[model samples]
Target: MKVMFSAFVAALVIAFAAPMVLNQFGWSVAEQTSSASVRLD
Candidate 1:
């Protein structure tokens, strides 16, 4: 039970932090899709 609790906490922290970490590198889902729409227009 202790090991499972620790693993759950670690996963929660990573899930919350991953997006902020990725955004620092300028990776974005909206930017990519918007550019494609502009090209089609």
Candidate 2:
């Protein structure tokens, strides 16, 4: 019920907020988006 819904919201916040917070310290999380067209030759 309420607890489960709150936990889900908290998890969502952490997933997005954690990376932003960490990046402020000169760190970054790996991105795996499909729109990237990088190819190392």
Candidate 3:
């Protein structure tokens, strides 16, 4: 049980921190996907 709990905590931390780390490198999801949208100007 203790090992499982630790693993869950580690996964949660990674899930939350990974985005911030990527954003630091300017690799945000919104910026990447926005380019694919049609600009109906």
Candidate 4:
């Protein structure tokens, strides 16, 4: 249970932090995803 909890926390941190790190490199992930979603509609 402890192992699983630690893994889950690590995943959550990565999920939230990855986008900011990528954005610092000028990767418009949110913009691209939003535009793609709009096009699908």
Candidate 5:
């Protein structure tokens, strides 16, 4: 029972945190690409 409860909590935390983490990473990548100084000139 305790193991199941802990697993449920872990899943909940991951469900909530995953999106935020992914968003931050996506935004960082986008920012880097947009502000890249290595122009293909």
Candidate 6:
């Protein structure tokens, strides 16, 4: 039971921390691409 609890806590911490870690290196799911152009007629 203790192992399961620890695993759950670790998973939660990783879930919350992964995004910030990725963004620290300029990697993010919301990153924008400049190659796509929009044409409005």
Residue-level lDDT of model 4, residues 3-39, one tens digit each, is 9999999999999999889888878866555653344
Instruction: Estimate candidate 3's RMSD in Å.
Output: 3.4
Question: Which wins on TM-score, candidate 1 or candidate 4?
Answer: 1
Candidate 5 regions exceeding 4 Å error are 27-41
Candidate 2: segments with Cα more than 4 A from true spot: 29-41
lDDT per residue (tens digit) for residues 1-41 in model 3: 99999999999999999988999998986887787658697
lDDT of 6 by residue, 1-41 (tens): 99999999999999999988998987765565533567879
**Worst lDDT window (10 residues) for model 5?**
27-36
Model 6 scores a TM of 0.69
lDDT of each: 0.84, 0.78, 0.90, 0.83, 0.84, 0.84
Give the C-alpha lDDT of model 2: 0.78
Decide which is better by lDDT, 3 or 6: 3
Q: Write the per-residue lDDT of candidate 5 for residues 1-41, one digit (tens) a residue.
A: 99999999999999999879988778666665686466686
Worst 10 residues of 1 by lDDT: 32-41
Top candidate on TM-score is 6
Per-residue lDDT, model 6, residue 26, is: 70
Candidate 3 lands at a TM-score of 0.64
Candidates in order, TM-scores: namely 0.66, 0.61, 0.64, 0.61, 0.62, 0.69
| Candidate 4: segments with Cα more than 4 A from true spot | 29-41
lDDT score, residue 21, model 2? Answer: 91
